[model samples]
Target chain A: MILFELIAPIVVMFALSFLHADRVRALLALSAFAIMLPAVQLLLQDKPFPLLGDYLIADRLNTYVLLLASVVGAGVALALMTLQRHVQVHPRAYFRFYRFFALFWVGLEMAILSNHMGLYWIGLEMATLSTVYMIKTNATRAAHKEAWNYMIVGAIAISLILFGIILIYAGAKPVLGEEAMYFTALLGAADRIPSPFLFEMGFAIVTVGMFVKMGFFPMNLWLANVERASFYPVAALFSGILESAIMVGFFRFSDVAKIVNFSHLAGFIFVYALLTMFVVAFLIYRAKDFMRLFSLSGIEHMALIALFWTSGGTFAALLHFGAHAFIKPALFLSTGVLESQGRYHIAGALRGYRGLKGKLFWFVVGLLMLAIVSLPPSPMFFSELYGFGSMIALAKSGHHLPAMIAAIVLLLFLLSIIFYRFVELYQSMKYEGEAVEKRVYGSELAALLLFAVGALALLLPFSLAFLRSIA
Target chain B: MSAFLTGAFLATLVAALFATRLYRLLMWYALNSLALGLLALLIGSGLNDPALIISGVLTLLLKAGVIPLVLKRLTQRFALTRQVTPDIKVHYAVVLIPAILVFTFYLAEPIGRMVGGNANSVAVAISSLFLALLLMMEHRNVAPKIIGFLMMENALFLLGTTATGGMPMLVELGIFFDLLIAIVVINLLFRREEAVE
Candidate 1:
């Protein structure tokens, strides 16, 4: 039945999690396959698949994100095969590592599929719990600090969302009873809820929690700190899988606003998006490290995504995520290459990598940044264009006002900040003409090329339809 | 009875705000969860809800008993410094706590409109959330930070039992699972922290 098909992947991945230490690679590969098979299967189908009487549903958004998450999961596993040499691990430890990694994988899958608020909370908590272990793979002082900060912050965020969920229950109990927290049930009964004000309060609270989970503005600092501490593969899962999962949470929360015509939710999204755009633009200039710089760019991308979502461009939102998810792991792991080789000089001396290996890394990283900045030929460029167009459309639909004008002003400020930093960095490098040469290791060239192709392929006009027209 | 129990639970968290000994903080958490459990049980009996009754027993057995015992053993296993007050000055905390309570009371006015039960209890539950966040923001040490997280969960349980009269059974079970697993993983991280030290 449909239930078995949906449940099999998690069950298999959970089983693989118990593999012995020597089978760490196998455990990882099988876990990736477990996630991918069902994801690909779902993607191939045009219809939504609901299981457990609609508590867990796989729709266009969920399936597309799953396929995207699996791609990142596979990329991380594949990249690890070549790059995991630096992490020396005993058999027992290796087994333990993969077990938690598999759990994190399964958790993300569950989170996307969940329709019941309760199931969604559990899935997210599972992912967060596993991440605490993942970030601790390096037992250094800074890593420990980052891990604890991550754990504490995640706990707080999850609890806030839970409180919000309970509020939804409180508000809906009289009309819909306990089933009010179930997405399917709530859909039919949302309007009959006791008070609209309480409903907005709950939705707003949940959105705040999602914002933190997605690492925007004020909560953005934690991602960089945690990434700096995590193993590269584990961090890739976060950038790719976990971040997208949180975006789904955002989409779902925003859908409630759409269902009930709650203007405050739209206003909330616009305010945070503008503030995040303006704030991180300045913060990116102050980033002292490369990973930190990339992490800050994540906020910018998320902000753009928020803009499109608030403007009601559902397809644009999905396309932006598709582009970002595929491209981020390559960008993240290349930075891993630079950091590991001790040659990741950001905006400093013209001490760049030389020779073939250096040339490949330099080219890949440059391409990644270009994609991040949404230059032409990159998928993000198109997505950003669509986002702006949609915002204008939203304005045409009676949404433009003093607030939208202020948002545009904020956008202009963000543009000036970004261009200013680029000029500064360019001039700084120009001053130090003699660049340092650094060596790259393994199939670095082939991997970067592969990633580059994958990223570029997402931008094709037809491929955009694949995601945009998703169910 | 439910209101008194929830109030006693909030009191433990406030006391923990001032307590310097880590062991005492854990005990306070245990007592806080015990109050939450009793409140759940009392509410279940009053409403005649079997799901709430099951939730109450689980809260009593796991959060009140098992989790604190695990944390106690964790506290004893390492020569960890018992940091009761990690960062914020007492005067600042003293002023902040009441401000949080009042702010949440105002917050409850909007929240109070949706509740099917006592509006004052709803205000208290919402305030407990702020108080828990204050506990977290006030501390810097890992142990106290972790305890602050536990306190947050306890506050949420109060929210569920009082505001909604208890969530569906399935939701409560998922929550308890998360709390327990979080502690286990956190204990591992603590061990690694000790090893790093």
Candidate 2:
């Protein structure tokens, strides 16, 4: 069951790439793989399996991440299908795009499931390499340059991570001795490891590298450029799924290694997150392009919310992760459709939309806005509330009180107004001037509904408890 | 054995500081790798492990000899001009080198006592790290950056050997494989750069 859950999507994706049929068939294969996720989770409940000389493992953490990946992966695949239909001229590269997307999805899942640090590094590199190709698929000069930047920065970060891994292995060898690269073994003997300074230093370096990968501020130049240049489906996955997988890795590191002194790490991340959010908020106001603006805002908010996780903000991060996972992709997919109809600017796209009524487009857009801004009864609202509580609790405990208080106040004020503006935009019918001839299909609506229902269900007590335990 | 290892460490450090041009940089890398190889051999001999000795000799031949030779060929093919203007000026490096030396010695003292190893090995390992960082910062061209990266890897290999005697064979093999792949990727990147130009 364990190996099947971990390996099935990878094998299926590879196999699907070999099929010389329509790209829609590959989409079906992806959906089928996504379906296996819940079944696998059901079987792996409270059961752990270590495989391949302990290079991989199936545990609660892996299961939770796998579930998240499957959910987002399904949404992305569906979004891609809609995009392919909308953008009619790009027929030749369609299969290739889906193939790369499928492979990227598989690689992300593997990275999350990897137990050995080396395997994790390899999985991450594979994901990076695959995504580079994806970014270049648009065939624009700007896209190529962005992909180049992504590859170079990603290479540097991965190399640093490898160096950090070597340092850790070197430090741990005296205590844990030979063949102890697995997370479990290292964690088991973390307390006894000689040269705590080396371990801490390694952890710090690795964290910085991973932060670069996660699109944290100061290292986030590549993200905005990539999102702005790449296709919308790609933007959605980069913002939604890829970011979450890296977060899972960070969460696991915090759980097992505990290498970072939380207070200090939180302080560092908080400052950057706040700065990023402020910059993004300002940029959003000036943003003429809709997709770029929302995607940039998502990246900023992701960094901000991620700090909650570092500061012992638990249930909040998990809920926000799920909420954002559902909403961001829907918005990006809608943006893609708009772009296909020769409307590139957000204000233009929203204006003169006479044909898209009671369709999946508006419904998806509405849900996405609600979720992104964490409107009432959405999982994000509860998550943000809980996150603030956690921050307040930590601050009261005398851990960087001023910074935490400032972050809370800033997050609340910014998010509240952002939500209000989004709601206002959705309600206004100013963009109903021209009719959109091609109507959105039933399957796309089903996919959007699936995500909306999933996000709503997550707010339930039973589901929340289940997810919290696994996470 | 300890004395030989200490001598190699001192020689590598001196080479790193004195080396000037690209050829000198390669030469300095060779000397550093050779020191690492000898240290690995000594550790193997001390443990009475034949396989370790063989691997040590392999490290010496491959890292210290063949790899540098290959890098030299690549540099020649690229026809990189001599680095007349390094990122760090000579006077700054001259001052920085001694400061690093002093700092490493101070940093390694307590660590050496705790780990119960030769303090000189720790000092050399730390110095190599700083040197590698310096090499990376100094170079602007792609080829030199690749060389700098390779040197950093060699430094890490030395740190592994000196700190823990040597990592598991699997890990050593992984690092080597990673380096091999990295070199290929670097070459590809250089090719792309040429194409763009």
Tens-digit lDDT track of model 2 for B129-161: 667666666766455555566666666666666
lDDT tens per residue, model 2, A1-471? 545555666556656655657755655546545645653554356556654557667676666656766776777676666565665425535565656666676567667777777667666766776777677666666766676667666766766676677667766777776655778888787777777766665666677777777666666556777887888778877766787767766676555444435555665567767776776665555555666667766766687567668767777787787777777776776676555456443443444333544354665666666667777777877888888888888888885678767777887777666666666555542253344444565556656776777778787888788667754
**Which prediction has the highest lDDT against the true structure?**
1
DockQ, per model, reads 0.81, 0.24
Name the regions of candidate 2 deviating beyond 4 angstroms. Answer: A15-35, A42-44, A51-53, A82-107, A190-194, A256-288, A341-344, A351-358, A397-403, A413-447, B1-113, B116-155, B175-197
Candidate 1: pairs in clash = A351-A436, B20-B84
Report residue A128 deviation for candidate 1 (angstroms): 0.6
Q: For model 2 chain A, give the 10-residue run with minimal summed lDDT.
A: A345-354
DockQ versus reference, model 2: 0.24
Best by TM-score: 1
TM-score of chain A of each: 0.89, 0.88
Per-candidate TM-scores read 0.92, 0.80
